[model samples]
Target: MAAKWQVVREMDANLIDTALVEAAYANPALRALFPLVSHGSLQFSRCTRFPWSQDLPSIFPYDGERHFRVRRLHEPRGSGREQIGGAVTADEAVELVASHLPPGCGPALDGTPDDLESLS
Candidate 1:
């Protein structure tokens, strides 16, 4: 089965940078499982594996409201990028991302008791 990944908490847009760093720090084990890259105003958190020639599953902030957006980065080809979903909260965003992640990525942070397993 593919591993699943989810956000541990709701990220505040006012402190997005701090939130991202704190989330990784709070979940050190899962931190290494998914790498986060920030470029200017854009941030990318990848949680899925992909073939050498394909793109991985990633999430970023959209609009000024900091709505969470998911997509696959095709890189140089840049032809396959598509918006997978959008949510008003980080937690919801992760739930949406979880549905598309490959098996074994980790666990879903859907504010459920099972979420605790991922942090353990």
Candidate 2:
């Protein structure tokens, strides 16, 4: 994935989605990850750069019901993803994501993963 990371973000209140906000506060750990929206769904990244890896789970709020859904993004795009579980609240959804986080996963990287690669 050598494409640039282009995320649609509107700081304006009217353009923002409530679900994105809900997912942000779902968990402190989730809050720590870089938040972004993909195809109207809330997704988090472990780094603030392009080509977001499958390091974190993607969460979606069902049809404005405010019900959160946590899913694991699998490789080979369009192969479908795994449904980890569902949550009545953002907190619960993030809790599920938190448990599945990679071992030793910390706050999102401040830079691209490539930045780290160069450091080593």
Q: Per-candidate TM vs. native? A: 0.46, 0.67
Q: Give every collision pair in model 1.
A: 1-103, 2-102, 2-103, 2-104, 3-103, 3-104, 3-105, 3-106, 4-105, 4-106
Write model 2 residue lDDT over 58-104, tens digit each, in one string.
77765566677788867523457888887556666767788888775
Give a tens-digit lDDT track for model 1, residues 16-99.
544543443344333434443444122223223331222344567676565667676556337777777765455555545555
* lDDT against the true structure, each candidate: 0.44, 0.63
Which stretches of model 2 miss by more than 4 angstroms? 1-23, 75-79, 115-120
Error of 1 at 69 (Å): 1.0
Number of clashes found in candidate 1:
10
Q: CA lDDT of 114 in candidate 2?
A: 73
Model 1 TM-score on a 0 to 1 scale: 0.46
Which residue pairs overlap in candidate 2's backbone?
Answer: none
